[model samples]
Target: MNMALLPSMVAIPLGIAFFTYLLARKSSILADILGNLATFSILVISILLIKTRGVYVIGGWNPPIGINWVLDGLSNLVLVVVALISFAATIFSTRYMEQYTARYKYYSLFLLMVGGMNGVILTGDLFNLFVFLEVASVASYALVAFGCNHEELEASFKYLVLSSIGSTLVLFGVAFVYGATGYLNMASIGGIMATGNQNTILTVAAVLFIVGFCIKAALVPFHPWLPDAHPSAPAPISAMLSGVLIKALGVYALFRILFNVIGLNQLYGTLLIVLGLLSMTVGVFLAVGQWDFKRLLAYHSISQMGYVILGVGLGGYILATGGSSSVAALAILGGIFHLANHAVFKSLLFLSSGSIEYSTGTRQLKEMGGLISIMPVTRTTCSIASLSIAGVPPFNGFWSKLLIVIAAIQAGFHAVAGITILVSFITLISFLKVLRYAFLGELPEKLKNIKESPALMGVAQAILALFCIGMGLLLLPGPREFLLEPAVNALIQGVEYARIVLSGS
Candidate 1:
C-alpha cells in the first residue's frame, strides 16, 4: 500500500533498460534474464497493489503544480495488465529472439516500452501523460522494424510517420488545455472544466484529444497503420501492441480525459458509439479474408476494441443523460472486463502465430496445415485463444461479449445489440478459417518435420491460454467485487476523480 511502490512500476524497467543496453550488451543471455526479471518484479508489484490506492507527489511537490502519480482501481487494473503481458512477452522472447542479432538492444527497447506504459497508467499530469505516451510510442516504432528487413522497415516507417502526426496533435491539445486552464495537472484542469465555464478553446482541445487518441487506438477511420505495425513487429512486440498498447494509450486515455477530465456529454458519447460501430463492422469484414495469421489477428484487434469502446461509451451516455445507475455500471463493467480478456487472448493468439513462424518459417495460413500433428501445444493453445476470441461458451470472451450485448439491449439500443451479435458470428467464421487452414487441413509435405515451439514459448503461451479460460471467474460476485468493482466505481465517479486525487485520502 505504500505510495513509494508506484514509481518503481516505471523505474525498475527503465533502470533495467539503461543497464542492459550499456554493460549487458555483450551477452544476450544476461540481457534476456535481466529484462524478464525486471518485468516479473513489476508484475509482482502490480499484483500486490491491486488492493492499494492513493497519490504520490514527485519531488515533494504539491498537487496542481508538482507531478503526481495517482493510484486508484482503474490505474491498478491497467498496471497489472501491462506488467503481466510484458512478462509473458519477455519470456517468449528469450528463445524466439535468438534469430535476431543485437538482441540486447531489443530487450532494452522492450523494457523501455514497459516502463512507458506504466508511466502512462500512473501519471496524473497531462504533460507527463503525453511524455509517457511518446516514450511507449517511440519504442514501439523501433520494435516494429527490429528485424530490419524491407517489409519490417517499411511498416515501421509508416507507423512512425502516422504516429508522429498523432503525437504532434496530442501535444497541441495539451498546450491548448494548459493555455485555457493555466494548469497541466489532470485534476486541476478537470476541476476547472467541471465549473461549467469551459469555452470554445477547451472544446476544440477536446476534439483534438479525441482525434489524437482515436488515431493511436486505431479506430477505423485512422486504422490503416495498425494492420502493418502489428504484424510487422517481432511476435512478442506484436503481442504488446495488440494486447495492451492500444488499450492503454488509446482507450483508457480517452476515457480518463473525456469521462473524468473533459467530462463526457451527449456529443462525445454519440461520436464514440458511431466510431465503435464502424470499427466493429469494418474490421471483421476485412479480417474474414486475410491469409496471414498475424495480419488477421491485427484486424481483429480493431474489431475487439470496438466492443470496449461501445460498452464504455454507452456507460458515458447513460450517465450523461441521467439513465439508470445499474445500466451504466453494467455497460462499463462490460467494457473493462472485455478489455482485460482481450489483453489475455489476443496476446496468446499473437504468440501462437509467432511460434508457428518460429518452427515453420512462415506466417501465411495457406502454407500451414496439420500443425496439430507437429506442434500440439501451439495448436491447442491457438485453438483455445481462437475459441475465446470468437465468444465460444464458458471462455473468457463469451462472458464479456455477453455483458456488452445485454447492456446494449437493456439500454434500448436494439440495433447496437444486433450489430454486436452479428459481429460475433462473423468473428467466429473468421477464426474458423484460421483454424481450418492453419491447423486442421491436410498436412503439407513441406511442414512434415516441423517441431513444437521452445519450452519457454509454450509456457508463456499456456499462461495466457489458461487465463483465457479462467478469466470468466473474475466475473463472479467475489472476484468481481474485489478486482472489477473499484474500476467501475472510478469511471462512474466522473468528476469525483478530481476530489479523490486532490484530497490524496
Candidate 2:
C-alpha cells in the first residue's frame, strides 16, 4: 500500500459516518457492518504505517507552506491504540446497545468520534488539530446525553458548556500564535519562533494553551464534567471517552505543542508538575469515597493521567536544565508508556462495569455482592484490570509506575518520587474496597439469577486482560527497540522536530 494513503484512514470513516447517519432509520444492520468495517480497516492501515515513517503533504503541498500529515513513531502508536479500542468497543456495543433504541444513530456518532481522534493524532497543522478536537468533543457531548434521562441530560449539558469554553480558549491561543508568527502550519511557526527572542504574545499564547488543555484533560480544578459525563453515557461510549479521548485530544496535543512547537522551558515544566500533583491527589481522594461503580473509575482516570503528565513534565524540566539525557529519556518513556497502559486498563475497567450493569441492571457498587459466583468471566477480567491499575507486579501498570519513580529519583526530585509511591499504595487501597464491595462478600438473594454478559463482551474483556499481561514484555530489550524507543526519541528530540519537518518540505 502507498504510504500516502494514510490520510484516507481518517477521511473514509468520517465520510461513512455521515452516510450511516443518513441511512440510520432505514436499516440498522447496514450501520453496524459499516461501523465495524471502517474501524477494522483503519487498524490494518495503522499497523502498516508503523513500518513506513515519513510525512504526507495534504493537497500535494509540503510542510512550512502547506498542510501535511506526519506519520512517525508517536503518531503511529496513538493511531494503533485508537483503532484497537474502537474495534473492541464496536463489538461490545453491537450486543450491549440493543437494550436501547436507535442503534444506527449510535453507530454513526461512534464512527465520527473515531475519525476525529484519528485526525487529531495525524494532523501536522496546529489549527487543524483544534478543528478535529472540536469535532470529537461535540460528538461526545451528544453521546453523553443519548439516554435523555434527568442525570444524563444534566451531565451532557455541563460537559458541553465547559468544553465550549475550553475550545474557545484554544482558538484564541491559535489566533495569537498565527498573528505573532504569521503562519498556521506547526513546523513553520516553530521555525520562526526558534529564530526570534521571546515576547509577550508567545508567552500569553503558551499560557492559553496550557489552561485550555488542562480543562480538556480534566486536571483537578476542571474535572467536574468528567465524572458526570463518563457515567451518564452508554457504557461503550464511556469506554471511548475515558480510554483514549482525553489522552489524544488533551495530553497528546499539549505535549506536541509545548515540546515540539514552542520548545520546553522551566516555566511550562513547573506548571505541568504542579497541575499533575494536584490532579493525582484530589482525584484519588474523591475516588475512594464513591459508591457508584463507573464514577469511581472515572475519578481514577484523572489520577492516572496525573502520573503521565508528571513524568513528562519532569522529563521536560531535566532537559531544560541541561541534565543527563538518559534521565530525560526515562521520564518521557515512562509518561508515554503510562498513557498507553492507562488506555488499556481503563477501557477494560469500563467494559467490566458495563457487563455488570447489563446483567444486574445497576451500577451501584454497594448494591452488588458476590458477583464472581454468577458472572465468572466478568469476575476474572475485572480482577485482572483492578490488579493492573493498582500497580501490582507482572502487570503493565507496574512497569510504567516503576519507571516514573526511578526517573523522578534520578532527576533529584526525591519528594516527587516519594509522593508517586504513596499514591500507588492509595490506588491499591481503593481497588481493594471495590473488590470487597462489588465482587466478593455474600451474593445478594435478588441478584443470584444474574448471569454473565454476552459472548462478545467476554471476548472483548478477555482480549484486554491478555494485553495487560503481554504489554509487560514491552520492557524487554527487543520490543523496546521497536515500540518504546521511537516514541521516547520523538519527545526527546523536542524543538528539533520543527527542523526535521521543515527540512522535509
Candidate 3:
C-alpha cells in the first residue's frame, strides 16, 4: 500500500525540528504553527493506516539482513495513539507555552522527541530501537530541565542518571543477543532463538533486557525520577511523558522483546505479575497523599502502567501455561486497551491540570476551589478524564479494566482479580481526594478574578475528553474485530512474528 508514509513518519517531524530551530528562531507563533502542522499531518496519516499492513525494507535491501520499517497489528496500533496524543499536545502547547520564552527551542526538542519515538516503534532492528530510544530519552532529559530552575534541573539530573543506567543495560543486552545470534534484526534474532535453544548466556541477556526495560518503564522501585521529572516539565510535556512515552519506550519495548525475541514463558509471566502488582499498589497508595496536582497525576501514571503490565502478564501466563486461547486473548486485549485509553485520558488530565494552574497560578489542590463555575470547560473536561480513569461506565477505561478482571477470573487467578479490584477502588479514593479538595469546595477569594484557560488549551483537552468517552466503543463488535483483535492476535502469535515479518519482508 502506501509504504512511503512509513519513513515519512519519522522524517517529517525530524525535518521540522531542525527547520523550526533555525528559521523560526524569532517567531514563537511560527514555531507553534509549524509544530502543529507537523503533528496534525502525521495524525491524518496514522488514521489512514487503520487497515494498512506491510514491511518496507529500507534502501531496497532484503529484510532480516537490512534495516526495515515494518507496519503491522502492533506497531500500527501504537502509531495512531502516538500521533493523536502528539497532535493534541502540540495544540495545547500553542497557548500553554506562552508562559515560557523561546518557543522555537521548545518546539525543536519536542519534535525531535516525537521523531525518535516514531523511529522506535517502526524500526525492525534491535540496535536501531536502542538508538531511537536514546534519541527520545536524551531529548526528554533536556525538556525536563527546560525550566532551568533548581527543581527542574534537579529532576532532570535524576532522570538522566537513571535513564542512562537503563540505556547501558539495554546496550549490554543487545551485545549479548548479537554475540549469541550474530544478527541485530529483530526477526532474525527471534527466528534463531525459537529453535528451542535455551542457554545460560541467553538467560543472562534476558535478565539484562527485562531489568533494563523495567527501569525505562519506571516500575515500582525504578520510578523515582518520574514523580520529579514529570511535575518539573511544562504541562504538554508532562502529558507526553505520562501518556505515551512510557508505553512506547517502556511497556511496548518490554513486550516486543520478551514475547517476540526471547519468547514468553512461565517465569516471564510470573515476573511481570510480581512487578505489575507492586507498581499498581504502590503508585495509587502514594498518590492518595499528594496535594500537588501534577505530582498526583504522575504517580497515577505508574499505577496505570501497572494495569497494562498486569493484564499483559496475565495473558502471557495463560498462554505459557496452555490456558484457553480466548482467555489469553482477553487478558492481552485488556492490557493493550488500557494502554491506548491511558494515553488519551492521562494526557487530558495533565492538560486540564495545566489549565487550572494557568488560571489559578498554583498547582496545589487545596489552593483551588469551586472552579466548575468559572472555568466550566476545564472543569468538565477534567472531570471526564477523572471519571474515565476511575473506570466509570461509558468511558474507555471501564471496558479495559472489566476485560482485565474478567480474564483474571476466567484464568483462575482469583487473587489477582481481587487485587485489580482493590487497585481500582484505591484509584477512586485518590481521585476523590482530588475532586473534593480542588473542584467541590469554596473558591478562594484570590482566585475569584481568575479566568478559564485559552481556547486552544480547552480544544486539546476536549479532544482527549471526547476520546475518553468514545473509546469504549472500541469494545463493540465491529470495531473490536477490526481494531483490537489485530493487536491481540499479534501478541497471541508472539514469536511467530518472526515468520510473519520474514514472509512479508
Please, what are the lDDT tens digits per residue for candidate 1 over residues 271-366? 888888999999999999999999999999999999999999988898899999899999999999999999999999999999999999999999
Clashing pairs for model 3 are none
Clashing pairs in 1: none
Predicted model with the maximum lDDT: 1
Cα lDDT tens digits for candidate 2, 1-505: 4577787778878988988888767777787788888888888888777766677888887666678887777887888888888888888887888888888789888888889999989888988999899989999998999988999999999999988888898899999998888888888777876775486898899989988888888888888999999999998899999999998888988998898888888899999999888888899999999999999999999999999999999899999889999999999899999999999999999999999999999999989999878889999889999999999999999999999999999999999999988888999999999889888899888897878899998998898899888898988999898778888888888878878877765
Full-model lDDT, candidate 2: 0.88
C-alpha RMSD of candidate 2: 1.2
Would you list the rank order by lDDT, best first? 1, 3, 2
* lDDT of all predictions: 0.92, 0.88, 0.91
Query: For residues 38-149, what per-residue lDDT tens digits would candidate 3 score against the true structure?
Result: 9998898888887888888998998667898778788888989999999999999999999998899999999999999999888889999999999999999999999899
Q: Please identify model 1 stretches exceeding 4 Å from their true place.
A: none
Cα displacement (angstroms), candidate 2, residue 324, comes to: 1.0
Q: What is the lDDT of residue 422 in candidate 3?
A: 92
